[model samples]
Target: MADRETPGDAARSDRRPLDGIVVLDITRVVAGPFCAMLLADLGASVIKVEHPDDPDYARGFPPMVGGGDAGESAFFTQFNRNKRGISVNLKSPDGKELLKQLVRKADVLVENFRPGTMDKLGLGYDELRRCNPRLVYTAISGFGRTGPNSSRPAFDNTGQAVGGLWSMNGYADRPPVRVGTIIGDLAASLYATIGTLAALRTAEKTGEGQVVDVSQQDSILTLTENAVVRYTTRGEVASPLGNDHPFVRPYGQFPCKDGYVFFGGYTDKFWRLTCEMFGEPEVADDPEIDTMDKRFDPDVAERRVKPLLERWFSAYGKAELEAMAGDRVPLSAIKTIPEVVEDPHVAARNMIVEVPVGGETVRMVGSPIKLSMTGEIPLGAAPAPGQHTRSVLAELLGLDDEAIRRLAGSGAI
Candidate 1:
């Protein structure tokens, strides 16, 4: 926290959600970064700790438009926004001492290091908890902290596979597919954030802290949805059902004149409205497709509804069909990234933001969490590697210019 007049001052002046909270973020890549990012968004002072020799692996990932010494990638920038970075060589004794100093002040400490990595680094939960008994320590792994597969290295791909998400996607005949994005990592991060916040609240009440164990594998299992329920109730291994749902009729994407428009007439009334709106009320009442039971019948809906829906959507343009669909049915005019950027609804919602980077303005998504009292902090472009190292150390750690230069010279910052 800074003095009474600084930006950090305003950030910590009053309890704006998680204000007065301090987090020492030791995570890397998506899962860890995402958890810390959420805390930062909610008003925690998040200090992202990285190694001095190497930075976050995401910093080197490609699609690097601006050339720099750190090779900071766009991926890193997106997830790591609204965080201050510090470099510490945790392998060194002096670095570990520095980390202990940080841990002493942190209300929460989050790490995604594999099972015993932190223990090896001598910053295990048991050790850190001794330093600050009120610290909420969170660990995110591929499997979990305990289990047969606990020690095995896991990433987003492994989580998706074992968690049954991959099995439930794509066409039945085709092989299981990893989702287009890091769904497993994001899921684990979300769970981690939830656990951290809950623990923080509890600690505030009890004056004690606990560990939060979030497994990517377990988080992906959440996506299994009814798969587990069906299996437990009646021994069944569900297969991928393609574009159509196993239990909903006329509830998927249909072709349009230019592109695809997704419509989910998932109920009897929506089905009726969809049919009448598309000038085909006959399909809505037909015994073969009217009831939920028959609508989920793949062979029946494929034969009867697919062709008719296609023709109807083709007859009307995407916009007209969208207008007709209206709020009567769950519908979306399948938009591309650029279309979403330009969409009036998205703009009105303040989803897109223009951030300053040098003299240029970079376009990105603003924080989604809106506060009624204190608003979300306006974000700037991602910091350059160690961009805030000197300033943060001098301000937060009370290190002067000579001390910083000494730490940097020793390669132990």
Candidate 2:
């Protein structure tokens, strides 16, 4: 794999899809911040707002680089890059007014607070839409805004369980498991981003903005399609398959000499190819497993097909098998992080990126979206608390030094 910079100058250097857009990010932790981060990556001028006394709780997350508040949490840096930082004490009257002014000017506002928190602050969508008719107001929460459980506090794991992912994600004999990554939060963030963008476009055309209510549970539920359909349509409640797919046999991971490879040679055509590759051509023509439906049957797969595949798979190492399979077989050796970093495909596509944090360069995952015209600009560092506070207030609200000093003295900023 070749390592290189993100492409930005190949097309129009001055043009970006969201170049003139302004995003106000009043969010904390994973889901909401990640949604704003994606917009910032697309060239929106995003202002990340935090409370003056208590900053984003994620800043204190682990793997701290020990530069005080400037570059403290690597975790926070991963999600909050490419944003301007400002602090405002929302509980204060002056701070509330300042945020209202920002709302009037922003094209989009994203928040992940509990359902009624903003309403209690008098900064809810109802009040804010009065000031800016074209504001795209988006809220990401554990439950929906109007649901019975909307006011209850929830986290990623809560969303997973409530959304039905946790119940069907593990082996039948063991306790249910959450997915390896924070898929609950990640899924919600993706939906929130899509909803916000859709609303922003409609606002531009109609001269009206609408509320985008994205619930973590609702987002995750969409991903549970297969399981939900099985129960509702067939009266069959699907449990965990333990590396096996619901119907496909010989289609999951198998151990090799060095590591494992996921093989999808389940259909009749691919099954014949797999048998030929395994030097067992006779097995491919066997009457019991000749058809795709017969091979897909659970009992037949366990009784006959699995033993033959496992026996063949154990003789080859990952790289040797990959070299022999070429592109004909639907197979891949799972890559470790080191292997992924050095991979030619990843490097050629610039899938691993470096952004500066303090004096050091930190590597993070790159954006997956690759538009011909929208190759990314270089990523910016996450900010210290209120790093652009005075400048942003002055620039956006026309506040001079005396006014900023008074607000600061009053603990409003």
The TM-score values for the models, in the order shown, are: 0.91, 0.95
Q: Give the C-alpha miss distance for residue 180 in model 1, angstroms.
A: 0.9
Best by lDDT: 2
Give all candidates' CA lDDT scores. 0.82, 0.87
Q: What does candidate 2's lDDT look like per residue over 264-379, in tens digits?
A: 99888888988888788888889999989999899999889888877887898888888878878887887788988888889877888997765678777888877666645668
Q: Which pairs of residues clash in candidate 2, taking residues 3 or more apart in a chain or in different chains?
A: 1-343, 1-344
RMSD of each: 5.5, 2.7
After superposition, the stretches of candidate 1 with alpha carbons farther than 4 Å from their true spots are 1-15, 68-71, 357-359, 401-406
Residue 316's lDDT within candidate 1 is 68
Tens-place lDDT digits, model 1, residues 1-413: 95344345335433468878998888888988999888887888888888987888887766564556534466676778778888889998878877887788889999998899999989899998898899999999998889888889988999999999899888888986678789999999999999999999999999899999999999999988799988899888877766766577778888888788888876788888888886778877887788867777778788877887788888766677778777787777888899899999888667887765434556777677765456546675666656678877776678899988888887778
